[model samples]
Target: MSLRYFDNLLKSLYTVARMNEPAKPDWEKIAAMPEFQALLKAKRRFVVPCCIFFTIYYFSLLYLVGWHTEMVKKVVLGHLNIAYLFALSQFFMAWIIAFLYTKKSSKFDQQAAAFLDHAGFKK
Candidate 1:
């Protein structure tokens, strides 16, 4: 092949590689954005409370299981003790919280997308 053809091939490969790469966000601009700040605040508002509540719930359950054996052993259903129910409920609670967070985060994603588009970050 001619040198000219080789140069053209290299340029074409470089162009294709660059095209496939995602554009990097301007971190300085993103950090300075009011929308981004609001996103952080909104995320914290949901997450902080969730963390606090779950921490309390988990510790209380642990305490009850460790210190209140009689209370935890009391049958609530057909041979299902309070401890058993509480243990099982932890799985359900986790799933429910995860589902809720997924639902909530979609809204945040939408808002973030809009903000990015407004800031000329989206292609």
Candidate 2:
């Protein structure tokens, strides 16, 4: 059989399986769970600081380029100027944050699994 045919077959099987599964938990029940609350708190702790830092860091570049054009144009190394370097640094900063978030998200997944188990729900 073709790959596309197998893919469609699998999708139909998945839909059938989903239809047979138990109902999802209510949102209120999930919200009341201590483990779920801890998950939210943990996520906030990691996410809020990263967001604030990224916003300030990104905007500072714009502010400097717009208001302090001469400072931004000054050569930092070889022919590369401060603006070029700062803009380049943004790419690295984004990659670093994504890496960190990926690592942290695994922990969040674990927490979510534990919460599911605690709630007597099968994954």
Candidate 3:
């Protein structure tokens, strides 16, 4: 066996080892990036208001059901009462919120991908 052969084998092994290991992003550096900060701010701007609105809307239903029983019990449709309609509206509300978030997150993801590229991180 030649010394050059052993050196080549070692090099091949090192290369294989590196290829098997996934590249790790530097969280601290990523966090420090202005692009990342802007992404977070943008997400916060959307998410905070959605969360606040959803919470208030949800609690208001509970409040109406618990305290304003007469109001909620009033018939709005042939069979559906205000409470039932309100409860049903929650499902639609959740779906709407989810749809909005999904739509918004795609933009966020694009921004994040750009951020990663700018930061020299592999996707």
lDDT of each: 0.89, 0.96, 0.95
Please provide TM-scores, in order, for all candidate models, with all chains considered together. 0.73, 0.78, 0.75
lDDT of 2 by residue, 49-78 (tens): 999999999999999999999999999799
lDDT rank order? 2, 3, 1
lDDT of 3 by residue, 27-77 (tens): 898798999999999999999999999999999999999999998999989
lDDT for 29 (candidate 1) = 82
**Local error of candidate 3 at 69, Å?**
0.3
Across 11-117, the per-residue lDDT of candidate 1 in tens digits comes to 99999999989887779987889988888899999889988888887888999999998999999899999998998988888888889999999999987887788
Mind sharing the TM-score for model 2? Answer: 0.78
Clashing pairs in 2: none
